[model samples]
Target: MPAGYSLHDFSFDLRQHMAPANVWVTSGWTSVVAAPGTVCGVGGCFAPPYAAPDSSLSVTLEVDGRELRDGVRAGIAGFGLGLLTSGGTWRPDRIERSGTFHQYDDGRLVSLGVHSRLTPVHGAGGYVLEITVENRADRDAEISIHPRLSAGQPGRLPLADWGWMAPRAGDLVAAASTSMTLRHDLLHSRVPAGGRTRFTLAVELGEAVEPGEAARPGATEPDPADRARQATDRWARRLATALDAFPRLETDIPGLAAYWHRSIASGLVCLWDNPGFVTTPFVATSGVDGGALCAYVWDTGGYAPHLLTLMLGETATDLLEAMLKADLTKHYAIAPDGTGLGVAYAYSGWSLVTLATAVASQRGLARGLVERLHDAVAALDARFPAVGELRDYGTQHNLLEMRGAGWEHVVASPNAERAAYLDALATLAEASGAVLPVDALRATAHRIRASIADELWDAEAKWFRSRYPDGHTELTYSVQAFDALRAGACTPQMAADLIARVRPGAFLGAYGVSSVSAEDERHYELGDTDWSGGGAYTGEAPQLALTLWERGEAELAWTVLSRLLWMGEHYPYFPQEHYSDRPAAPPVGRRANIIAGLAGAEAILLGLVGVRPRPDGGLVISPPPAPGNVALRGLRFRGRSIDVECTPHGFSVTVDGRRIAPEGGAVVVPAA
Candidate 1:
């Protein structure tokens, strides 16, 4: 295969699929062991979870002494292999991708492909490459291939130490990536016209195999192809069971429906489930960037946990609660080993509380845990406080640090966030049947909400602005306002004024919502592509759409959501941030697999689907109006299976099997 092949070239779907090149298929767990489209080979991996990415072990192919260049197509599931005919018709069925496709030898077609499977969950051992040759002519094809694995630093092994492979008893050599190359495989295939034969090479890593106990790739041991398929099927089943049963999103939009599944797959890749790894269910920020192996509090603060809670239930809670091992009072992200990474970020405190509440209110958490989280927030409140008392949330960088330094802390969103979290926690505490101070927490929340309008409201601009340390209001427009709006910080008039500004050339852009208003030349000029000027934080696009929908801007919400469809159609998953096209600055965004696009699921569930778990152990489901026929099937909520469909008139909701027409789009499914 040519190095020019894109991610779309090797996509093979499992369970469900989309158009080829729309999704990437590889060995289940985020395909961590697989190559980056295999065009460059598997350089980036989540395995060994934190193994730093190095150069890729390159792969190439040839047939009858001539290099194969064209006529390659991806598998049906998107990861399998296929070839093209002279008439340009794609012939597909067998699997794997990358390497060369040699055209013909004396009018006989010869093609090569490999389906690879690496060291499974442990991430420590070797890998296997199934290199196959398909002869598409009347006479049998004779082939001899010797692939030397040469790199900057090839492990200086003695001739006796070289690993071996079979029917011709080949030798495997080590490269820079510790990759073993196939060599001296001179096998005259017994294949006839249109016949295909396999060359299964089993490789053992130098570090994984014992000197005397090493297994050799001798005489095609026990039909390896059949065994590989069975193992892959087992993996697929295990992964399907790892997550909670999610509601399938069916939509008229091209890739929107499949995006829901793709988003979940992205989250699956973030997990580091090696038996001996740090935590059993730990998650890294990116599936590809080996350097990013922590679950960022700021990212969790966004829509990640909301979707996680919805999908994995308390499992998601456990992963997040593990993050609390870090001294949250001073840091914002936590590694698998319990070390906090970033500085004391602005959103850490509430982000923790929000994570707790997402599960506490849904599946139910222990009373002791809920009480501890409440006290933790109280501690944060005492140290940081809200905008009214401290002029900031502990003077730390926030989600939108692009505006300016310390500017994140100066924002007015935390006050509302604090009030909202406290209210939810208070209710959660009561539900757990262990409440120490319900009235006090509610009273405090009430006071904070009142203070937001009294202190931060800019009557002149009819919006809210940050109160600088000097107690002067600075006029600015950014995505932060959307957070304040979600927290119920805006009055009817204030919300109308703030949301109306969400249009093109302002907060809203072609890609998504801008981090700051483009109209603010002075402030915007100071920012770059990392959620600042001329950049769209990829996660925010789906979220802004949800916010707009919830705030009753149905038409506008659809516009934003529709524009964000580019995410699923383009990349395998939503990236951290969408950089500007014009003479852009460096890609200063987080290593992806950030699970930012998870907000798309959140928007659908909470905003458009309008499924909210009430504090009183009931559900307030109000499916919002959507374009075309939209149905959410098999939604497992609070131990209840709920299916919701949007009709021309209101919505059709089903609990278990009986259908109920919500009077005003409000149906109360009692809490489990």
Candidate 2:
């Protein structure tokens, strides 16, 4: 592990947080959450009030027998968190925490100054707790620590999950223990005046099972301590690799580096590799929030680079190739059986463009993939032979409720996104040998851009208002305008002009950029649906930051990133969207999708360490000014692995050990 990107660097403490709150970690196939007690499942965790004795599904911690000194509850089914002994019944008088690890003072646990500590470890399919107790009195003392589990019932699975897919047979979950120095699940040791004892307790959530078989452990089971060490190291490396795998910001900015690491790490936990789904590695949330129960284009844009990098060979190529087959304009989400699941939003093509950008960033416009992209674009164009420009079905279906502009007008989002798609289509045709009418595609895209930039730019309000069929601009400041910027809908001066109006009492909120500007109270609201107003859709704010960074407003971009970083710090995993004035989701119906929250990582990846893959088969390296010495290493672009090293001294790039020359104000690494 390098100095900054070590295992402990990602550690955080939730002990003082409200009980039952969780911070989840995953192995892609398996997942677990840290709550009052270790919970293995989607969202079936609660504080105290445990189950009856020997319950089929529960996490238990038993110490001593009955009351210790006076009357501290112990050895009881569904215990109340305490231990009893001779001198004085022990309780947690004072507890301290450092990065998920916990410590307790002496004399509060038992007669002989019983001091204790807890260290948490995450395994491939489970989480482990290593509990240690020490005695400091003159005489010897006896201690017993029993970590018990009773999982898997007759029909019901112990580990509960938010049903992302239709229920299948053999939803089995298991539990394992490595009681190295214990008898019958009990760890007993006589602690001398200055002696100590330790043991490990672990629980696991397995992968999807076959009808008649049990679930399988995700990885090879190692000894408890080795498992802990190895898991920690792997996670550290994964986080560090994400820095290089995607784009990483090398800065000492307070909260920036840690925020970036966690932003990328959130993607790891959000991924659930259930074999039953249409896609093996699903982008659905692991019962957190955001209701992302299936693979989504919106999510693929944010986390795909890290996953794509891990699958650097055929698997990577195959996955990116599949994006062309995805019906981005069809459904908001698809089911496990490959059928549409959610709304067929009008601007759902935004999802396609989002994923398209991700694909471009990872693989560039490589020849073979460009051929596939050409076919996909041709088929997409085939749908609009008579519809003139284009318009998807469903009104006000961009993200959620849109009362402004009747939610059914000639909007800017889908137009901007379509222009992006068509623009990419033309560029892809030019880059590869694929034959297509590039001139027509470019002309159509330009016409759309011209229409938006000409009619939609509200000179009076300094915002791109949604336009209606009546040729009038809608009154409101929407975050979707930011989307237009992402799709190259705004000229440089126009982009600056639009961004200049984003401030405290307008589009910018205390948390991040609001879905609807502050003063637009008629349309702005703290509702459940995404961007359903008055709040920051956790994902869009990152896009805003990335857009700002692209426009050379690094400071403003950092402003937005830092505001959302506060959410990541407060909530271990970022939620879908939150209110501007508070750290909470909308008041109405809500769901969890760490995938949306994970977009924060994309801002870090593409913004600070900006490495964009252009549609013309070239990779662009144009990062924001670094306040310190840092580097983005091992970036796999256009089928070639490259490194971007930057410091206060000078920034440079190397492709396969050959230093490359900077061209046109940025380094353009040509396809190998």
Candidate 3:
């Protein structure tokens, strides 16, 4: 980390790697650094979130001892580029123009400065950097600038953005842009009042190839005024790069904490925001829908806990309180016995159950929150009375009302959804340590498990089946194995068997878990254009595969996860409620369906790391050995710091600087 500069590059290169949320900057010449083979991925250049602007500097580069010629490389993309020009009074003609070859984009001028000069900057190259202005307007503009140069490219000349910043020989720019403070890049020195401010960009050669200093040299001798700005930039880049692995899953079977998170938070957000109205029975109350589920779910359960614990540990208590307040409570319908309407028996209850347990078990919620959750569980519990139960509501899987005399295989049947609810409750109880009505909740869970085993599992099919009023099993691959796994009702072997039947191509699509199995006659094309596929454009959100991975199907889980990620990238972040029956079988993109991105992101977090938070203030850290190199750098968990680097050899973990012995490559850290 440099002293006055707010940015530092991490060894990680996202351009070649696929990550959940990546930021990069690219120009005509500079793009080679992000080219396929040389670097990791294409989107390699990006700015930090906290990138700020500086008005006191400029940048220039010369390649191989020569004043680098122009047009050789792509134009530059700077992170702190627009911050200086953002404010009207910061400096009229905020950008200083210099250089014979400089030219600005035409007609893009603002009253204070030029409108076209407005270029946005994100944390690119781990630096809160900005480009020098190109003085588009006829009049020369005096621009203060800050810039950075790193070692991601080669055979390059001094590249410059003709229309943005003037190429300077050696000037320092600010680290980031903000309202109150501004600091200059260490490399930049004040420029004279002229159009051509120049600064020589330098690079570390062969001898300095390795990191020479253990601690940052800049940290000790920081100027009082500029210290915070630089420090903030350094921290931002480290955190951004450090948390990259968790979001970018290289394999299947999420990290333990990530899995639970996908199940709870990501699950809740998706279910609440599901756009597949009438049939699927979930909708976004109000949020970005075009994303993935696992990420959203994991955010609630896994990432939220893990990151908050690591960085914002003390805020956990308050965050949980806020979460409880934001969540909505709705009544599906009420029976004569006062049991509120329940989701006939599907995946929705899993969200509620997961939340209840997470709140009670992890956060140590008081009696009020616990009791409220318990009451909901009790009412939900009552909705599924033994197996022969009946009610006037005729099976309401919430307010969606499953009204059909024929065997539609609606969720209204108690067996499936009921079991899911029980699974959630058990998880809550187990997580909370003290069960709500200890024996009663456990008893309810046991009964639900038994009912699922007796009524839902079809021996001939050798798998759990969806049910109808006639008691005929639909035998679809939607929620059966998943809910059973969640309820602790299925054996590992049973889960493995279910996985074998539902391969990604058969039952999974690019967007998410598919609704109908590829082998089924009604596969994707079957059913009505609107109210079919159980509201899912294809079928209900695929829960079967999701649960299998959560339970420990790493290899199998990755296969499904890859399909979902493919969908997210192409679909503009549609939450995969179901697959489209269109001849080509595309995904249904909706505003409320961002769960696709969420789930994909979550899979990387949960499956790879296997982070699970116990009822007691403790965490279970498990990493799966998968397809390729997996490295989880700065994973903050429960006041403990875990840095996981996975290579060809095996997994290595360091908790608070202590080498943790791998328990079969998995480690547990007691909570603070």
TM-scores for all predictions = 0.79, 0.74, 0.51
lDDT measured at residue 392 in model 1 versus the true structure, 0 to 100: 68
What is each predicted model's overall lDDT from 0 to 1?
0.56, 0.51, 0.35
Q: Whose TM-score is higher: candidate 1's or candidate 2's?
A: 1
- Candidate 1 has its poorest 10 consecutive residues by lDDT at 160-169
Question: What tens-digit string does per-residue lDDT give for candidate 1 at 336-418?
Answer: 56566666666666777777777765667778877777776676566564444433663435345664642445566767887
lDDT of 3 by residue, 1-672 (tens): 112111221111222222222122211001111111111112122111111111112233321122322112344522212222221110000111112233233343321111111111111112122223233344444343323333222111111111112112222132222111123444333333333332222111111111322113234423322322443443444334323323222333333223333322222222211111121212222132111111122123322233322222333343333333322233322211122222233223344445444444334555555555556545544554334432122333332222322223333233444444554555555555434565565566566566656655666666666565566545554433454465466556665666676554555544444444555543233443222232242212323334555777766665655444333222222332434322123223232222222444334555555656665566666756655676555455444556666654567767777888877556777757
Question: Who is ahead in lDDT, 1 or 2?
Answer: 1
Better of 1 and 3 by lDDT: 1
Question: How are the candidates ranked when ordered by TM-score, highest leading?
Answer: 1, 2, 3
Alpha-carbon shift of residue 67 in model 3 (angstroms): 39
RMSD (Å) of each candidate, 1 decimal: 8.7, 7.6, 16.2
Residue 81, candidate 2: how far off, in angstroms?
Answer: 8.1
